[model samples]
Target: MNASRTPLFCDTVLAERIERAEARLMAECCEAAQRGDSPGFVHVLAGGVASFAEDGSPYNKVAGLGFHGVPSAADLDDVEKAFAAHGAVVQVELAHLADPAIGVLLTERGYRLESFENVLGLALDGEYEPVALPGFVIRRSGDDEFEQWLEVVADGAAHPDTQGLPWHEEFPREIYLRAQRHSAAAGEQHYVAVRDGAFVGGAGLRVSEGIAQFAGAATAPAHRRRGVQSALLAARLADARAAGCDVAVITTQPGSKSQQNAQRQGFDLLYTRAVLVKQP
Candidate 1:
């Protein structure tokens, strides 16, 4: 894979850019819930917000802090208390763009480094050759098909290869459904891969600030190795490019098959981010 860099991947700006994007997305989800367009609630914070579902959603977490500068100890203390009030674990995703001192502060405050995710990006300045999965069809999903799309995605996520991974927990069906609805309400584009009119895989795309992010992508167990995901990626990238995005990004576990697939498709490592958590 090419190691070319863009402003979004620059060491000095990468963290903040990612944090901003995440914060924006989360805030939008909160708005959707407040408007009764979806399920969930948003708790505004000093520099970020806490997102929660009526049922426990691991998605409930804090984001977009320590970007302008390292947060004060008192500020961190308050943030922890706020998350605790919501009966949620204090989880934070710190990126390289954050002030280096933020890590030191988190460590001092009882947060443990949980895991790392490789952020990969692909520039959409050139022609993209669409991958053809001979017997599969990929298309954007509509509101009426949300449940079917969620089922396929949840099944794909539960595939054995994804078990025990931080990102692959099997939440209650209600939680998944609510989250999917909230995501759609927040403007995420859902896509599904089908063969013979049956769902085989699914993915989600969110575009902002000239960038398109492949937020979620998975293929059913029986559909693995059949280029289902590649076809989905191709379709999403083409759609994003046509919509005027200059870059496309995705995150995956380091050294996983997903990461390998992304690399094969011209995505390069932008940075690895740390997921930190403090249990009550």
Candidate 2:
């Protein structure tokens, strides 16, 4: 090991990119909820709770209830009943200023808060300085190497606790394949870090609406502590800057290791999202 080598961590500029990605992710989730898209339904699984309910898909389930301009406790009751029928867990997100009174009601009833994320951003054209890893190598993932990436992700997420909220096993596979196809169709970019010919870590960026949203970040457990993730993040930011994006963002749970990593990379906190859970 080189005595002068610096450990892997995020910087200020990279932090901004994650922040921007987070904002886009949150906005997308909210819109999905509003529109009752599959992605949106998954966010709130209140069964048939809303007066106006939209159904969900097999892969990413979602349903919309309640019309605008009218608030009803039945909407919450419907959601609770739905969760009971399915025994499913929903990821409920409410805007910071919207209303926590609802979330507070659920928390008082014994629902877990689970995890939360913070949104951060930075200009895409900004300069990015790489953290040092004397002997590590970074490169873009190859076309036929999807399984490798999946395996790396699976390996990283092997621990039950690391898996976060539970979903059917097939759900992640569906999301992963959809992401791959979306990336190819949209000409997205993915980067990976390799050590001694082993694929150890990865990161990706998708350009939409002239904004580059970063996603698909993972690192093999054994390869952590090396500069793999940091390098992948730096390279992704550099790629975003070159693509003419003005700013980048990322959303992460507050006080998570991911949040600490983003902060160490120099990302400032833009906003925090509060999640609500209602079990029937």
Best by lDDT: 1
Instruction: Return the TM-score for candidate 2, rounded to 2 decimals.
Output: 0.60
lDDT of 1 by residue, 156-176 (tens): 775635532455235676666
lDDT of all predictions: 0.74, 0.51
Which ranges of candidate 1 are over 4 A from the true structure? 1-9, 34-48, 160-170
lDDT of 1: 0.74
Best by TM-score: 1
Q: Tell me how far the alpha carbon of residue 130 in candidate 1 is from the true structure, in angstroms, after superposition.
A: 3.1
Per-candidate clashes come to 1, 34
- RMSD in angstroms between candidate 1 and the native structure over all alpha carbons: 3.0
- Per-prediction TM-score to the true structure, in the order listed: 0.87, 0.60
